[model samples]
Target: MLIELRPGTSAEAAEEVAARAGAHEDVTAWPVRLAGRVFVVVSGDESLAHVPASPAVLARRPTPDGHWLVRRDSGVAPREVTIGPPLSGPPEAPRQVGVVGGPRLWWAAGPCALESTEDAVETALTVRAQGAHALRAGLSKTRSSPYHFPGRGLRGLEALAEIRRAAAIPVITEVCDPREVAAVAEVADCLQVDGRQLDNRPLLAELGAQRRPVLLMRGPRASLDDWLRAAEFVFTRGNSAVVLCAGATGTPQQPGFGAITALRARTELPVIFDPSHSTRSASLVAPAALAASAYGADGLLIESCTKPERLYRPGDAAHMFPPESLADLVATCERVRDSARSLEVSC
Candidate 1:
């Protein structure tokens, strides 16, 4: 069950409640202030039979969705993560290219990893020209097998910073370890917690305390219920700037995106789609991306290599797209979105 304390509730009051609930050996309690509300999520003792009575309590509700805080019923306003400077801002003024999200569709595109400084910067420039809002690169890849590329590790962060400067574009990357959080934040406009790190509470907490918005990808096996609960871990620390990435259903070929509906229905966070990663086939990426856009995804994340032949991956030709194709995909998505709005207006 979840308990929400009224506004202006003292920190001590929440602490006292946690202390009281924690006294119960079978139960654990932690207080979080997220989205301007103070909530205490107590696991184990769902009935709150032994909880101390207090005036701070504003509401008490059962958590059927794993974590009550993320449910739409919590009344948290929907959050749209704004990245980069506003698009209309002067391009020559500090940065050359910038992106924004909320009422507008934004795209983030780049290769899966920073193979080198030159390649990374080159890819960023290509995507920026193609209207990419942010550059997505992997500094440290938490892939399933250690045998595969481990990315450039911390060295790639230096390249990422350079990419931000040379390309004049915002950088989005992942931090696999909690220790890497501080360093990663120095270069990343947005931090990502991949499926492998979905349950890493410490990393989530570390990211939650930072200023950058977090892009959390749903694990292959995670249900909407599980995904929402995982998001709470980040929200618990203070920052609620979280964007959920609905991923595939384990199988790379299947590209299951049906959960977008459930995610939209449950959480207020802006939900995006990663059809490129979901399908793992370049031929299917555009179609899947277009399909997701029609479903009203707040943003699209895709893998694109300017020179696909040189990119090292298991399925280069099958999975990686060139910059031109993604630009076309974005343009097509915008046209479709505009048409849909017009239809609604006409009706």
Candidate 2:
């Protein structure tokens, strides 16, 4: 069990929370501080009812999956994770699911990896003009095959920083290794964890400690409960700014649109879709993206490039769509969202 004290909780209140929790037989309580927030973690097999009836207590919840993210979806509090010092933040508070102006479909379009400084900048600018909220500039990639071209390392991070500067928009990038979390957090407005890295407790804990907004992709074989439990890997440490990313499931033919709908009914955290990854085909991405929105995805991370065919890894073009198509899809998503809202409002 974890007891969350309100933000700016005083030391006395924290100690009191710990002391009261400690008084429970067979349970040990400790004070924890992370991501600039304070909370008490009670370790035991059973829940306690002796919680002090004080205003200092913000919430008390059980971490049944050994994680304490079991909060109500509608109880999301307003918070912001500053991207970085140099780059600008989102136009508005992001990660707020299903809000006015549409779903939290903060569009992010870019190549799977950084090709060149010039190409990254151009793609970022084009996507921003196409109504994207951020640029998906990956600094490092974990390829499936050993012979495939792995991404540029530190150079990629530097290039991404330059992309954010030139494009003047927030950047989202992947952190493949735990050791590089600090460096990646400094450059990326939001940190991304690949579906392959869902069980990387070390990496997720580091990201949680780094205190940046994280976009955690759902593992292909993991259940919805597994997905939320993985998110607890971050939330329990302190950072509350998390967005659940739904990707390809076990089947090759279908996207995780069903997971998106089910997750919508389960958690309040912003749920987004990665059509480019789910379908792995430029042609299939368009329909998959629309279906994700219709199924209640809060945002999207669409793979795009300046001219994908000209990429160093030409085979990557199979999954990347052009920026013009991204613009068309963005506009169409608005209309689709409007229609869905109308039906809900009337019914």
Candidate 3:
């Protein structure tokens, strides 16, 4: 492992960084310490760039304001590790399932409305209060008809930025256009690729260039291989924090085939399921969520509206379960997760 020191800093701190990076020789690691901040690099090769030849060599320098990612000749390359910690953070590897905010509930609420700026904040807060780890909003809505309502453009994105400001949990929104990737990167913590936009390879490539965590949703008609290959579009772009999402499919079955299981088995990337969209009904959301967990899905995303019928939206069937239903779903998911753990121990 290689360690670099900033211009004015002494070589003493580099030793500490090296020690931290090589703390576990079982896993190859690289850490750079400058001032009080530490930047880590994880790659397939053990050789790290230890000299400050250029400021551009730093892979990422994310600020509280905006990200400042520098371009370099050679940077942190991709590795097929099952788990790792954040680039610049504590040494411990993060747990597989990140709860909505706390506990082991890996749930995100997808509120499908962008009527007003106030509505965005209200909906996000509603989900966050109900133990949701993230707020999933759609900046670019894929409506059924050509005459249907789309998004509020760049103005709506500001609303999502505000929600992130007012809350502790992360805000996730979709970016359908390839051009919008840069703009969306400025605000949203995570970018979600809509099911319809899965076929748009260039857009996925552009999102990968931004080097942010992406939620790639499988298309309703797209096959499992098609979906995993789509993920490679991002992986090859040098972004490894890619997650697979099992969205609704166009199957004839009422609940649709268990595409979630097939997707999970196909890719090593963490898999999340959109139960709300899969069933398009509050009643079926629970069953779909259970199925996803049974098949080893990483998380669940359910559309939670304060009032589903009152919303000004065309996809009302997908929106179900007020705040109470979210709680119930969490409890049931916990039961299933515990059962799976027991089975693993017994075997």
lDDT per residue for candidate 3 within 230-291, as digits (tens), equals 66556544465666678677665244337755643334456678888777787788888887
1 or 2, greater by TM-score = 1
> Which lDDT values do the candidates have, in the order given?
0.76, 0.74, 0.60
Worst ten in a row by lDDT for model 2: 92-101
Model 2 off-target regions past 4 Å? Answer: 4-9, 12-38, 43-60, 73-104, 345-347
lDDT of 3: 0.60
Q: What is the C-alpha local distance difference test score of candidate 2? A: 0.74
Candidate No. with top TM-score:
1
Model 2, range 1-347, lDDT digits (tens) per residue?
A: 77878999988888888888778687777666655667787766455536777788888866666644534432432223333333334343233122211334567889988877898889988987787778887777777787776778676876777788788767788888999998877667788888888889899879878667888888788878777777777775567778778888885546878887676556666778899988889998888888877776677889999878777765788988879778789778767766775776431
lDDT of 2 at 99: 25
Alpha-carbon lDDT of model 1:
0.76
Error of 2 at 245 (Å): 1.2
Clashing residue pairs, backbone N/CA/C < 3 A, model 2: 104-298, 105-299
Candidate 1 lDDT trough over 10 residues, lowest sum = 85-94
* Ordered list by lDDT, greatest first: 1, 2, 3
